[model samples]
Target chain A: MEEFEPKIVAFCCHFCAYSAADLAGSMRLQYAPNIRIVEMPCSGTIDHRVLLKALEDGADGVFVAGCMEGDCHFLKGNYRAKRRVSHVKDLLRAIGLEPERLEMYNLSAAMGPRFAEIANEMTARVKGLGPSPFRKQTGGDA
Target chain B: MIVAEQKPLAEIAGMIGDCRKVLFAGCAGCVTVCLSGGEKETEVMATALRMKRQLEGNPLETVTYTATRQCDPEYVDAMADVVKGVDAVVSLACGVGPQYLAARYPDLWVIPAQNTTFAGGSKEHGVWEEFCGLCGQCVLHLTGGICPVIRCSKSILNGPCGGSQYGKCEIGKDVECAWHLIYERLKRLDRLDLMRQYREPKDWSKARDGGPRKVTREDVMIG
Candidate 1:
């Protein structure tokens, strides 16, 4: 049987993580290719619904990457992102999904190596967790 | 404003178990301002419920509608057509909204998604503090805009009980001494003399003790 390749969604802040991913490619860094990245103007733009939708859509894991603390170009975008990430994590756990399926990280735009490291780190974590339980059981009735 | 929190998803899920048709109702009043049950929140709840049901092998047919004010009879009446054939309604409004729906539509099962906490105002983003006790009286003018009844832990009428320390209440560091706030405002308004006058004991009969009180306006009465 083929190994379970978990579908992962990464919400990357344009100012930092997205640029970092670009830098990773420019630097010829090797990272897991299973994750699909969505670029947002700021990490704060990531809503709880987006994370929930990703899980509902059968993604094994989701994460938001923002600028380092106090380094957001929008001043407190990263702070808002942090609050949203925690909220979604709580919501997911309430529905029997492991909170570990969601993650929040902060890094600089120049950290190409760090972006690659995160990709590998999250991929390994999801592989160990198996598939999302939501992939099968719908909430109430059909 | 009113501050409320969402009920646990598991508890809410149980209420609508095996129900294919569902109504997700939102209130534009207190729940909306508190960021708990607004139009946007209704959409989110509808999506969450639908997705959850899909995961549980029970796909749901969900419909969402937010009223201008769920506490009003007219808005709830407007939902008559929308409620037809729906198995149950999950109200995202505050405590009043669900009761109103249940009262108006006795045949339809109404479930509350929010646990109403208290009458409060936003302290900051995602933070709210109780301000009005709804004691059936407004004495904000006497206190120089600071509410001693609600903000003060002890609900001291005259002044602080000498337990205030460093602008904080003696009972706990979290609670701010309401009298201190009143004193500062009076001093700034040059109405320090107002605080000197003694006040009589509050009339509890006019508050919660009144037992579902009601007021009528003669001028607005129909002949």
Candidate 2:
């Protein structure tokens, strides 16, 4: 049997998580290659539709990475993203999709190791859940 | 504004059952302001329904559109071309939206995705309470801006009923007694004299009991 490689899309705030990914690369940290990071001005910019669009477009899993609570450069952008992510998770569960497929993480730009850890963690979680039912049923290109 | 809530996911999914393609219509009016149905909510419902049907081994194709106001003929007419191609339409507006769409496109199946709850406004973020009953009569002036028609459990016009206990209604602990609210408001404004005036029974003909109603203004009518 061929090994399953999950497709994960991570929306990272440019102020924090995105910079952390760059630092991870410079440090030569090992992480899952399945992650595709899309940088946003702030995680708050990621609307529920954008998150669902990623899944609809074939992503097996999705997550938003932002600054720690009360530490957002925009004062409350990360908090807003957190609430939106939670709402999307409920919507996914209602649709019969596993809520675990979506998540939100808080971290600072200096946490290169933590960035790699999250990438690996999310990849492992999605792999265990297997391919998204969307891809399996629709033969969607993700 | 009209306050509404989305129907449960199971109920909505059942309504659209066995359909291959459907149009999800949203209203950018009162429903939007109340967070029940709008462009954002329309997309959310579309995505949810698509995934749900996909899971059932019956994939669904959804096209989404938000009219400026579904109650208006002009806004509903704007979807004529889109409605022509779909098997059904799921309207996420107040009750009026689905009715308007159904009247406009009699050939298409029109389903309501929300339950029209009341005529009210947001009391706070994510919280809404019933305010007006649309009785076609204005009595706020006598009631100190508190509406007994909606807030009171019995819709009493005279005074608090025997069921009022400790400023709360007998219907629910969370419900504040409307008469109590009126009393406090009137006392604060030094308008206690207004309460002494006996109000006659409301005219039922002005409300829904009169059957379907319409308003035509001679000045505004144009050929």
Candidate 3:
């Protein structure tokens, strides 16, 4: 049986994660192709609704990748993202979904290798969790 | 502003039993400001409900609409078109929002997604504290801005009751003594004389006592 290949949605900050992903490409860093990135002006712009919508649309896993601590391009945007991520994780748990399906990560634009590493890391983590419970149920609904 | 908290998912889900589709009505008024019900919350709830139901092998179809103010009949009327396509209506506003929806669409099932907590303002970013009791009487003029009715916990009219210790209510140190705050305010304003007069007992009939209260203003009456 082929191992489950999780569909991961990453809300990436344009100033950090997106830039790092581009850099990873320029550096020829290879990572899992399971991730579909949604670029935002700031990680803080990622609403709780956006994350939930991703899952409701059949994404196996979701994450917000932002700037490192105290390094948000828009001051406290990353911090706001962190708080929102925590809130969504709790919400997921309440809905009987694995909180592990949702996550928050911080990396600078200079971390090209780190960006690729995180993509591979999240892909592996979600793969271990298998297809999201909502996949079959929400696929047709979505 | 009216502060409200979202009801637990289990309770909300239970209230939606046997329904395959629902309309989530959100209000963009006080509830929006309090962060309980708004466009964002409306969408989030619809998504959550759909996913939860889907996981149970019972798919749910959801539609969301945010009215300007659910307490007003005009706003509730706007959701009429959306209500026609769903099995039930879930109001994300305070308690009044659901009542307004229910009254407007008598045949439709309306459920409240939030528990209306109180009339108050935010203390900080995410914390709200009750400031008004909606007793149909305004007494802020007599009590120096801070309301004793709701804040006092005991609703003591003439009190720093014996339970007041160090300006804190005996109920808990965290709770401020309403009378203590009143005295301090009147003192600062040099109006301590107002506190000297013996106060008469309030007329409770002005409140929600007469089996649902109404104030008719003929001047604003249409037709």
Query: Could you tell me how far off, in angstroms, the CA of residue B146 lies in candidate 2 after the best superposition?
Result: 1.4
C-alpha displacement of B29 in model 1, angstroms? Answer: 1.9
lDDT of candidate 1 at residue B29, scale 0 to 100? 90
Give per-residue CA lDDT, model 3, range B1-223, as digits (tens): 9999999887888999789889999999998999989999888888887888877878899899999999999888888899996889999989998899888998999999999999999999999999998777878888888787789988877776899989999989898899999999999999877777666877767776645888899999999
Candidate 2, residue B196: CA error in Å?
Answer: 2.4
Order of all candidates by lDDT, from best down to worst?
2, 3, 1
Q: In order, what DockQ does each candidate have?
A: 0.37, 0.66, 0.67
Which docking band does candidate 2 fall into?
medium
Which candidate has the top score in DockQ? 3
Q: Model 2 over residues A22-120: C-alpha lDDT tens digits?
A: 999999999999999999999989899999878876789999999988889899999889999998888888888898999999999999999999999
> Candidate 3 chain B: worst 10 consecutive residues by lDDT?
B202-211
- lDDT per residue for candidate 2 within B1-223, as digits (tens), equals 9999999888999998978899999999999999889999999899888988888889999999999999999999999988978889999999999999989998989999999999988888889999998888878999999999888988899988899889999999999999999999999999999998898999878888888778879998778
**Candidate 3 C-alpha error for residue A68, in Å:** 1.6
Scored by lDDT, the top model is 2
Please identify which of the two predictions, 1 or 3, would achieve the higher DockQ against the true structure.
3
Q: After superposition, how far is residue A62 of candidate 2 from its true place, in Å?
A: 0.3
lDDT of each model, Cα atoms only?
Answer: 0.87, 0.91, 0.89
The deviation in Å at residue A97 for candidate 3 is: 1.6
Model 2 segments beyond 4 Å from truth?
Answer: A136-142
